[model samples]
Target: MELVVNSPLQNQIVGGEEIVSNTSRNFIEANTKQVTLEHLRKDCIIPVFAKDNESTISHYQFVQKTREIAQDLFPEFQVAEPDIRISHLIKGRIPSAIGKPAKELLEHEKTLYYERCAFVMEIPEVVENVNGNNLALTIGGVRAYNQENLFSKKSPEKFKVFIGFKNMVCTNLCISTDGLANQIKVTDVDQLSFAVEGLLQQYDREHHLGLMERMSRYLITEEQFAHFVGKLRMYQFMDKSEQKKLFPVSLNDGQINTVVKNYYSCPNFKRSDDGSINLWKLYNLFTEANKSSYIDNNFERSVNAYELTNNLVNSLQSGARNWFLHN
Candidate 1:
């Protein structure tokens, strides 16, 4: 596996049918507005009360802390600017605003804090070629309204962080178990920074790349692909306990439908002439479909995509009881 340092890959992966070049962009992300790190730090309002403390981690602070720790940990690589997507505005009048109430005023006049935000920062200098596409080192975070009560300004704020690869061809993020922390519980910046530092420091890049490399060698025929898709759609309605045993992939019905569609029509990652798809392409399709997810579910699904693919490869190699593959 030859890694091209300083590859032409940039801020986004080349998505859909765009010319597959060194620099690729991503497919459009659903319900997200792309903003710079500076925009979030300077323009976004923080959420807190006058007399009490905050349980919420501001979008800007989360991104900044994660980015800073990542840079400090990987001193050899140059960190690019953070690519942030935010949605679900919490709009209201600021205590200092003098005119009318924010809702009464124009939409632009409100002091707003984003209730949901996700971002990816790539270290372009560290890169490798997988199958034919290039992947760069990428780190990202998700701040969403979830069961974790991520939006509450209480104690024990939670954030989802991941370290992985960004497909140069499109916005597909490649995350593995060694690189993802499903939830980081912290009360302040120091705790958050410590968590990020630990994850980056301990990430197994070689093992992660090995997992992806193994997938490229395995193939699933069209018949198996169809059966697998049908079973997955049904698995969602089954009991939760059953899903944990048979198919634990973290994709929604909408994301699965996108996989079915892309299997037939996607230019870069679709099936082959023999109507068979390799696991590598199959994995990328899951990630491509994941683009339709809102800010909150984005990272969770991305992390799941890689683990699912790696697990599938393990199933093929070891003959495990993964009905998602054999059945």
Candidate 2:
């Protein structure tokens, strides 16, 4: 199911104007690195199969224009390389000695231009969804930190856009740090956008909501409460002693007694002073143990119960904070 997205944002009027082109720039970056490693021995060769002068001129012009656009976008990266002589040849089928076909390459360049335009348009939305008003600050901080540390190797930056054709129904987004790639796959842009928006909203809601303080009142430490919550999640889904045996606590001198006392005091924990550990209690205990250590899953369920439990607690805490003031 799609998470959430701005429906009106899609199908908005887009100016049909050419913008910065990164096609050749991306292509060279992708190719050179691989070629340097000898992974791509000779420079990739693709044919230009145009029926007439107009068609052939159009294609060549597009390639040249795209190269110029790319240089403008990334002046540092686009430092002058020997101009690639695009061969003009006619054949029944296009020739591709190095990589994809000629037609494919042209289509790819067009895609790159459009993708950059789309990215510029959606920058606000992406920032709002990822880090809100603090997007620039976060990026700047990360960049500065990366720059300060000489030992830290930097990786090529990757950007992605989700495109949905035919309204919000069919959509996909392709992620590429592959500097060579001109065209990225967009399986369902609308759906992906919706999901991103939804996650952002969900995260926002959780952030506003504070912790389930009432439920956590009796817990000693955050870790203990986290464990308790983990067990609760496990018990809700897991079955019998088989699941029960999975979380054996490695007690130091009197850790079990300490856990028992903590659980007894907690409103959420379901254990009495009699030392009887209920299924709910067991779930939390097991979850905490697994999180503190490791437990192999029986494969009946997908996500780790402990991790989910912690996440749930965090969400709850965030929700609580949103609604109620914590002194």
Candidate 3:
């Protein structure tokens, strides 16, 4: 079936332009125009494939552009080699012989699909003294695959760029879903570097340092963690208000609690010696949960969870500030 996008933003952007057709069976064809991060969020159309003779950028080019932007922004800091990985979605077929060896059964594997690509580059670590102990600030940019699948009718295959931070002390990576500030979509090769630089500018030294200081000073208490979990549970049962528009479907209470449990039990999420949690830990919990929780194997569901959790964290931060002011 030919997939159709029902987004108003997409219609506005296309504006009666002819969509270039492609021969790839699973690929969706679209115009070869440059789209901003705003366009990606609203339109849900990704311009990954271009028409014949049209210039297109590869994943390697994207990494190079990111490195250039990082160098330009922080000349003193060195951009390390990017750690690259690929995800493969495969369908297993029944083996002809039931008793066949595992190695021989592998030959019967029918199809392997290219799911997505991801890469992370670590920036120069910042050392700070926190209560007579040295803490390292690990900052980097993460590029992950966002694309259309059988379940996702609106969103298309595109790469998403995120600026992430991790304090070695907590070993938790903090990510935000504020596309307007922290995220960007790669549409045009020419605009890739500019888009990355723009995100970096938003998280300038002063802003980044302030957040680091706040996280260092405020240790999350058991009460605060409970409050954050309560907010997530509220999302599960909240009325079909703004959330309905954002999430395709609300997560149930069981699913919410399972995610919370995973956060506390996961070995990767190490708690501080003081037994206090922080925003970084909370943020990592959601991101890690998204990695494992797949709704009917639909990629869109995972993406929605990631975005929802990010917004939740942002709200939690605002609530914390308000509490501090009142007390």
Candidate 4:
């Protein structure tokens, strides 16, 4: 069985609202390139579907509708420009009997479209300072080519949306289960809007923030950190049945290596002189390491990091015999 986690701060009912988000950003290892909202509305081509298949929601449609919902939900808060990223450019030439050469017409006559996109918009006015790190209220949704099923009109399209605290110091999103809506399937703007509103209303901001505050209070010494790291490194090598008895692993080998490297050198989140790091710092380190993941996997990995770190904090406090955290 997995380690039993108990946190007083969770579900304590100290808040309101939910979060929706799309992708990760920190000027880190994302393959996505920044684009403006206008670009999607004006330049990007919505994918064409086969006769029996219905068209999925366009990138612009999902993002714009979410923006509208955020405004309606939080009318007093100022919403920032949609921070958009797009990738996998698909360009093709339409058949044309050009007077010019084919070589010259190839680049000029091609229609362009992106296969995947995601965006985040910050509500700067709704802010919180947890241990000197400024976290703004952030909402965003992700749309990728893999989520679309163009072969069947009967299949509903899936979209992932999230909202939570955006760590201002490092720009790593602090997401929890209460703030995310993954695989929320909808066919149109109205359905998507309803899903977003439901997600928003379900979030408990005060409780989520309180959990972070609690994490900031617990400290893990460097020795314990090394021990924990060793256990985590061994997790993948363990037999499947044995591994299944505990929590599923979150970081890959490279991400784990990155976490270890950043523990000693991360500018804002490294350990203290006494070789101790608070859980909140460890949480950031996890999110920071998560930057190496692909865009599609980013949202899930981010949530996993939060869950793993929260478990560790509980493990630290309860003196539980967690395989990863205890001897």
Best by TM-score: 4
Instruction: Please give the lDDT score at residue 118 for candidate 1.
Output: 83
Please provide, for model 2 over 1-327, each residue's C-alpha lDDT reduced to its tens digit, 9 standing for 90 to 100. 111122221121122122112232221111111111011112122221223211111222222333344345334553232122111111222233235553444422221101011111111222212111112100000001111222333222222221111101111111111111222222233332333333222332222211211223222244445465455444445567655554432322233343454555644444555544433243343323221221111111111332333343454556643111121
Query: Which window of ten consecutive residues has the lowest lDDT sum in model 4?
Result: 1-10
lDDT of 1 by residue, 233-285 (tens): 88889988887776477788988988999999999999999999999999999
**Which stretches of model 4 miss by more than 4 angstroms?**
1-28, 97-102, 106-108
What shift in Å separates residue 90 of candidate 2 from its native position after superposition? 37
Q: By TM-score, how accurate is candidate 1? A: 0.84
* Position 221, candidate 2: lDDT: 43
Score candidate 3 by lDDT: 0.43
Task: Rank the models by lDDT, top first.
Answer: 4, 1, 3, 2
Q: Which portions of model 3 miss their true places by more than 4 Å?
A: 1-56, 89-113, 125-158, 169-171, 176-187, 216-231, 242-327
Off by over 4 Å in 2: 1-186, 202-208, 212-216, 220-327
TM-score against native, each model: 0.84, 0.19, 0.51, 0.87
State model 4's lDDT: 0.77
lDDT of candidate 3 at residue 218, scale 0 to 100 = 44
Residue pairs whose backbone atoms clash in candidate 1: 13-24, 13-25, 13-170, 14-24, 14-25, 14-169, 14-170, 55-153
* Residue range 1-327, candidate 3, lDDT tens digits: 112222232233233233212222111012122222222233232223333333334455666677678778778877765544333222233445455543454533322222333444557455554332343333333334333333333232244565544334333334433322223454476667777777666654444444434543444666656665676565566677855554343345655665568556756453555555655444445444443332122233333444544444455566644221122
lDDT of 4 at 34: 62
Residue 92, candidate 1: how far off, in angstroms? 1.6
